[model samples]
Target: MDGDFWHGNPKCYRVPKSNVEYWTKKIEGNRARDKKHTKTLKRLGWHVIRIWESALRDEEAVATKIRAAMMRHINGETT
Candidate 1:
């Protein structure tokens, strides 16, 4: 699970006002690292599922999405 801010979710992430530059760089770095890691995992033949922290509020919805992703993966769908 990824925290919205830490993962730099564009939907709802803002750099802290106290240290704008630092936080911006930090979050940007985190996002870059996340992308790199995900790419590596995919290159190694792993299905990557990233669920945001906020989305965890709805367990049923998350489960359905996961199931759908799993089904797509099983069906050799590149998603």
Candidate 2:
């Protein structure tokens, strides 16, 4: 799971008036790193499940997603 702000959530991120360029670059870097890491992990045969902060608002939905992922992994369905 990742924070909406720190992970560059398109729905939640708003550039600060002060130091706009710096913040934009910093957040963009974070997003790039996250994408790279997720790709690397999947390449290494890991089942990467990314949960957004906003998704946590629905506890049941989050649990269902997690459970489904786990089931897939256990059943050798996830790559």
Candidate 3:
């Protein structure tokens, strides 16, 4: 996910006081949708590797993870 707020990051997201219910529902829906999509993709034989927004803060770690996933896929190890 690109955004901490929309993706429901516990350490970063806080519902706005002005419209608590609306924000809560919106963020929750986003999380549900993300989960559903990831599950669907995996079921369809996709290697779904989710890199959180916070992980992007460390460029080297993100690159390493991507490389590892690619290597795994190349080795026919989807799991």
Candidate 4:
């Protein structure tokens, strides 16, 4: 997630909303839909890692988590 940039107002940012809100909005599926999809993927033997936008706020931690998830997926650790 990128940092907000100051608008013409000098105080207000040009973005529409916080990163969390933006992601939540972008992920349009309902909670039930997500649960079903996750369950299906898990049953199909996949490592499903869902990272929230807030997690990316800390670049280092985000990189670590992403790397770990990718490694785990590549190693066939799940199902």
lDDT of 3 by residue, 1-79 (tens): 4478789887788888888899999999999999999999999999988877987899899999989999999999977
Root-mean-square deviation (CA) per prediction:
0.9, 1.5, 1.5, 9.2
Superposition-based RMSD of candidate 1 using all C-alpha atoms, in angstroms: 0.9
15, model 3: CA deviation in Å? Answer: 1.8
Q: Which stretches of candidate 3 lie over 4 Å from their true place?
A: none
Could you arrange the candidates by lDDT from highest to lowest?
Answer: 2, 1, 3, 4
Clashing pairs in 1: none
The pairs that clash in candidate 3 are none
TM-score-better candidate, 2 vs 4: 2
Angstrom error of the Cα, residue 58, model 4: value is: 1.2
User: Which is the better candidate, 1 or 2, if ranked by TM-score?
Assistant: 1
Candidate 1 backbone overlaps, count: 0
- Whole-model alpha-carbon lDDT for candidate 4: 0.58
- Report the number of clashing residue pairs per model: 0, 0, 0, 0
Candidate 1: stretches off by over 4 Å: none
